[model samples]
Target: MQPRLNFYKASQEAYNAVKNLENYVQGCGLEPRHIHLIKLRASIINHCAYCIDMHVKESRHDGLSEQWINLMSAWEESPIYDDKERALLTWVDAVTRVADTHVPDSAYETLKAHFTEEDMVKITVAIGVINIWNRLCVGFRAMHPIDQPAKAA
Candidate 1:
């Protein structure tokens, strides 16, 4: 489905403002892979096929193996991810589906064990941003074709 508007093109200033957060998050010591994971999790929670397809493509560019990427939906049962990655995934799920799960103390403590305060803040911000983007894409019914590649960030 076509979007009601080309949000990126129609509002360059607003788009830049959001894009600028990427730079800020980068400064907070978040890895590119973690950022993509956050995006993928949020996309999955929001059921945004456009964002999922987009982030999956981006993740592949950053060297994420197809197995790991595909296993993200079943991360709990997958052996590919480590405890830190598992913790981050847990946080992503809680935050992305906040209304359903709420941000639990266990998840917070788990995340805190793996991430510094700065990293935690950055991760949360990353999660928040992706959730926002997911909502926008889902609400607008953004569509992606199977053969098309994601546009670069």
Candidate 2:
């Protein structure tokens, strides 16, 4: 698909505001692993192919296994993730679908079981950032790179 426009060039100040939030998420002490997982899961739910592609590559570079990353699409049925990872995945799902789910209390309980209050807040912020990215990319039809031809891994 083609891009509608360059979101970064449209307004540098607006981009920087969101970028600063993203920077905070990066240093917020949430595990890089969990952060990557949250990103991929949210991108999937939002159906933002640009973000899904970008995050899959980034997650791999950060040392997540291809098997694990691939299974995120089917996380509910996958047995690969541990309890802590499972909790964050659940939180990602609920928050990403907040309009429909109302950010359910059960999801919060699951997350609290594994993470501290600070980490829960950080995770929510991380989820919110990715959703913002998904809206921007999908709304603009932002295209993923074509550095290599697509094929099965």
TM-score of each: 0.87, 0.95
Q: Could you tell me the C-alpha RMSD of candidate 1 in Å?
A: 4.5
lDDT tens string, model 1, 37-102?
Answer: 888877887889999999999999989999989988888999899888999999999988888898
The Cα error of candidate 1 at residue 134, in Å, is 1.0
Write the residue-wise lDDT of candidate 2 on 1-153 in tens digits.
678999999988888999999999999888899989999999999999999999999999988999999999999899999999999999999999988999888999999999999889889999999999999999989898767767898
Evaluate all candidate structures by whole-model CA lDDT and list the values in order. 0.86, 0.93
- Candidate 2 versus the native: TM-score? 0.95
Candidate 1 segments whose C-alpha is farther than 4 A from its true place: 148-153
Output the lDDT of residue 139, model 2.
94
Question: Which pairs clash inside model 1?
Answer: none
